[model samples]
Target: MDRGTVGSAQSGRLLVEVREEGSSAVVTPAGELDHHTADVLREPLEDCLEKGYARLVVDCSRLEFCDSTGLNVLLGARLKAEAAGGGVHLAGMQPVVARVFEITGAEAVFTVHETLDAALAD
Candidate 1:
């Protein structure tokens, strides 16, 4: 497993953990994600996509905050996965994070689930 810390402002913190599971790559993000941390997500995510993983799951249950930058990274990841004949799913989004997606009209764009288990089941 590899971990990268992103945001560290007084607002919150963000850490992204990357791990492999069979043919898929899982990115577990813990903490707040804003403009400062969005790029941190893009790097690893694009790396996994380029590695030919068939599925990408971003676990956000532990995420306490997010901004448009974070959302852009997610949408970008989804696009990358689709371009590679793969899929991107979001799991375990906290209420605030979920609300960001909804307010931005991204809830309809992402296959978001309440838990990692549910996302994996799909």
Candidate 2:
């Protein structure tokens, strides 16, 4: 995956960073997320689910854009997380990134928080 550390992926357009906070795994994808960069985010999310850390928190404060491929990655992660008796939480979405969710009704499927701290608290 060319990651500098475990559970992280970085490319020219995207950087997906993963960290554990309590029982939750917080994945922060910073930069554009499109067809080319989707796997950078997808792999770690699936890794967390496979490891049984089903409570996934996506810190999207730094994310700038998301295309259908990127959205699909998240939706897939959410379903897997739920199947494991946990769920995906999205926090700190920028207006551009949040609009994609709002228009596609993806936001309703996720627990949206205004900040990363709120997501962690929940």
Candidate 1 Cα outliers beyond 4 Å, as residue runs: 1-12
Off by over 4 Å in 2: 1-6
Model 1: per-residue lDDT, tens digit, 23-80? 6677887877889877667777887877787589888887888899988898988987
Best by TM-score: 2
TM-score of each: 0.85, 0.94
lDDT of 1: 0.78
Residue 91 lDDT (model 1): 93
Per-residue CA lDDT of candidate 2, range 23-69, in tens? 88999999999999999999999998998888999999999999889
lDDT per model, in order? 0.78, 0.92
| True-structure Cα RMSD, model 2 | 4.0
**What TM-score would you give candidate 1 relative to the actual structure?**
0.85
